[model samples]
Target: MKVTLPDGTELQLEEGATGGDAALAIGEGLARAALAVSVNGELRDLARPLPDGAQLSIITGKSPEALELIRHDTAHVLAAAVMELWPGVKISIGPAIENGFYYDFDFPEDAEVSDADFERIETKMREHVKAKESFTRQDISVQEAIEKFKTENQDYKVELIEDLITNEGAETVSLYTNGPFTDLCRGPHATDTGKIKAFKLTSIAGAYWRGDAKRQMLTRIYGTAFLSKEDLAEHLHMIEEAKKRDHRRLGKQLDLFHFSEISPGSPFWHPNGMKIWNSLHELWTEQNARRGYNRVKTPILLDVDLWKISGHWDKYRDNMYFTDIEDRPMGIKPMNCPAHIQIYKSERRSYRDLPIRYSEDGLVHRHEPSGTLHGLMRVRHITQDDAHIFCTEEQIQDEVIQCLRFGFYIYEIFGFEPKLELSTRPEQRVGDDATWDRAEAALENALQAEGLEYELNPGDGAFYGPKIDLHMKDSLGRSWQLGTVQLDFSMPERFELAYTGDDNDEHRPVMIHRALFGSFERFIGILIEHYGGEFPLWLAPVQAKIIPVSDLFNDYADQVAQTLVDAGLRPDVDARTESVGKKIREAELSKAPVMLVVGAEERDAGTVSVRRRHNAGDDDAKLTIGELVDVLSAEVAERRRPDAG
Candidate 1:
């Protein structure tokens, strides 16, 4: 049989030939470098038999999919090492994740494992790699696979095979073996353990099996792999930088917020954190007004019937919080769109009011899993900078362009350049194919009209519509999805929303759901890390720290703080009766954007010496009270970053 290569060249091979055989047919060098083969765009193990007349592309170290395969192969090496080090350890599933891979294991009660064992595990992994153990794949009957694991006391593998057969109606399962370790996996791994050139076991944590809270907790080991040691070193350096800039640590150091057992995923915002929230809130309000949006608020809880009509009951009910109110089921709103739709339907609107824009800084609650919650990044309680636009189909392009520009404008203020992604309709959605096609086309046209380049993210849209998602990388080079503009034709139809057209007939108004800042909680977390707790003047909780040289100048510092307050600047007087030098050190540690040092000389001169944190060029410029306030207010008004210059 003959198979087509990526370059459209055909290669003849034996009937039982595998991807390995095809690569060797192409060239010896390619066969040696081949990690796997992409059979008809799907990755297949090199040892797997190649299909006749299939298009095959060699997956080498340079391929985008290489890292995932490397990490996954490394995970097998890790499991093999751990089981060797500690006998009787039961292994669960292991898969490659973003940035790395992790394997969950049910450690024996007598065994204690931690990151301290990483060195030994890595040593054993290297030995396996040095052995050049080729990954051998075998297909076995489901019952035989179950029996194999059951006899080995690997209950997890037994359970998995049973699920595949009972739930998925599977009759066969695949297993991969390297050296003496075997795992039940549907895999497309590297040819051998030797392919994992550089790897490190990064961390260890506890995770409930399959993310179910009721299940037994398993020990999870995370590690990353790269083709070269240089790439691994760079990634390790970034990981170290990320640790120093972790928002949770900064939040505590800066007195921003804290999580409590009383409310698992809810944040108890400190006064300092509230300052950041208010700053973003103020901007959200001002921008909405400039864009002709009417700000509104809605109830947090609504009847589940509303969700059923919105199709979220069927699609998103698993992630929602539900309660009983007056014997009727109520769902805490996970999103504001359904509630906003009700407001749109309340009044009879006209084509003149077609582009009715409603903006809400609304609080929403979701039933997030306990393990998935991160300090502020992932929370059960959230405040969304959400807005919905009701407009005619003809107005879609302009309205969408406005939204795109609005998102860019907001992100640019924080020194972020967001990349756009056009996400199309999902398989499980509420609308007809024709409506979804129109919605997707409208979004794509808007993006083209704006002259913006975007990546096509297929089947990742909301259940109601297709959307344009904005993802931005932060200072640490980590990308995050923050803004979205979704176009929906289904919601209006489902809710029976209408506006009278010029023809004196009612027509369904298209709904455009948009948000520049996805959620206050998550955005603040990103900002905390982005700025490294050294916020700009406008967002800084304590914009200026007023330090008096001694108790003699305390009164002057108080007066200065008051003047700053009257000028709409946040200032705090550091009057601890400490030395001026000590006070300055503490102020710097606090990350105050500006420090106003008041001494006898400045007091006599009726001015304050200005000291900018993190700025080495310090002449300690003296300015009068009036001059100081003007400069600070100007910077705050402009929302200038300390490093913008």
Candidate 2:
């Protein structure tokens, strides 16, 4: 057999040799360092047979693929350690996630597992790594696998195997063995446990079996692993930084918002939080107005049949909140597109009014799982920056281009570096293949016209249409999806929307569903973490804090604040009768962008001493009251970031 390396070098080998043999033929060091093999662009286990005339690339520890493999191996070792510690514990499934891996186990009631158990578990995991056990994979029939688990009283494994055979039409399943521990998995694991060098079991939580609330709850252990200790330490540091930037904690500290028992997933906005929310919404409205979009409002409670016509009832009824008004079944709207369609159909249109844009801050409701709800990121009620456009098919590409530009403009205002993704149609999509093909091409061509690079995400678009998703990276290097521009041919047809064309013939119009800020609550949550609660001057709830150096100058502080308000600035007097240092500390903790400290010297000169947040040991800059108002008002006007000049 002839095997070709990427460098165009061919080598002769045995007909049924494995990738390891080819690596050995190249060099002993390469063979020893090989973690896995890429055969014809597919990642494969080193133990797999090398096909005739195969293209092979040896993956080493330095390869990006090695980390996930290392994490997978670490999870297996952790499971081994658990079984060694607590005999007779029932193991479920373990899988690798984005930054780490987790294993779920159904332990005996007396096992007494907790975060305290992590230390001993880590010790045993290290012991297993030191033992240097090689992983072996075996392919067995489904019946054989089920019988094997049944013998060991492994109900979870048996259940999984049964489902695989019944649902997936599986005849064979692979089992991976690392010494005494074996699991049902399709694996390309590390050669030995020693490759899992740096790992830590970070936390523990409870999860229902298969995420079914009625099933038995199992203990799930979460952990992360890396190639080197230094890399692990760096990841741990980032995690610690992320902890400090958690929005819930920052929300409490900054007095932004809160949740209560009365309304489980609803946010009760304080003055400060409402300020931020209103600012974002107002800016969005203003931008829509600039683009010739008309603002509109629709009812939140609609007859359930409306959703049935929109195709949300049969597929999405489980996630919708339903109610009975006078014994007639109605639902809290889960989305705004269906309502927007009704508004569009209310008026007649021609080719001259072909591109009619309507925008709204639509409040929607969806039944999210209780466990999945985070402070403001996920909530039962959402305020979507929703907009819809009715246009001729010829205008699809151009309209998509404008929507993309508008989204970019919004993200740019928040200093987010935008990344674009073209999400393809899902299996359950509404439109025909020809319409889908045309919609996909229009979106792709718009991206190409803008000269922006994007990745293709298959089977992730809305059920109604294909979409272009926009993700933006924050200051902490975390990505968030902030917007989407979706093209829909199904809704217009379903709604039977029509317009007079250039030829004076009635024709169905195309619909585009767009949202720049997906949800106002979630966007503010991202902004809170992105800025670490210290929002940019324009978005800051309390733009400036006026702290009088002493009570003697309280009048002067009030006067300073009044002057700021007259200049259209949001400022408040921080008069607590505390020491100047204490007041500064409190103001800074609240993340106030600027602090105006007035004292005897400043009051006599009609100037206020200014201290900026996060700037310590710096001499105060004294500016007259008028000059200070100019500085702040200009910042508010320009929407400058804290670090920006």
Instruction: Give stretches of model 1 more than 4 Å off.
Output: 12-18, 24-29, 47-49, 106-109, 138-175, 180-185, 207-218, 299-334, 338-347, 369-372, 427-434, 616-618
Candidate 2, poorest ten consecutive residues by summed lDDT: 636-645
Clashes of each: 0, 0
lDDT of 2 by residue, 239-326 (tens): 8888999999999988889999898889999999999998897799889999978999999999999999988898899999999999
Candidate achieving the largest TM-score: 2
Per-residue lDDT of candidate 1, residues 1-645 (tens digit): 999987888899999899999889989999999999999999999988888899999999999999999999999999999999989999999999999999999999988888889999999999998998999899999989998999999999999988998899999999999999999999978999999989999999999998998999999999999999999999999989888889999999999999999999999999999999999988998889998999989999999999999888988899899999889999999999998988988889999987999999989998889979999999999999999999998898789999999998888889886899998988888778987777788889989888899999899897778889999988878899999888888888889999999999999999999888899999999999998898998999999999998899999999999999999889999989788788888999899989999989988898999988876475888999999999988898888866686
* Candidate 1 C-alpha RMSD relative to the actual structure: 3.3
Please give the CA lDDT of all the candidate structures. Answer: 0.92, 0.90
Q: What is the lDDT of residue 504 in candidate 1?
A: 97
Q: What's the lDDT for residue 239 in model 2?
A: 88
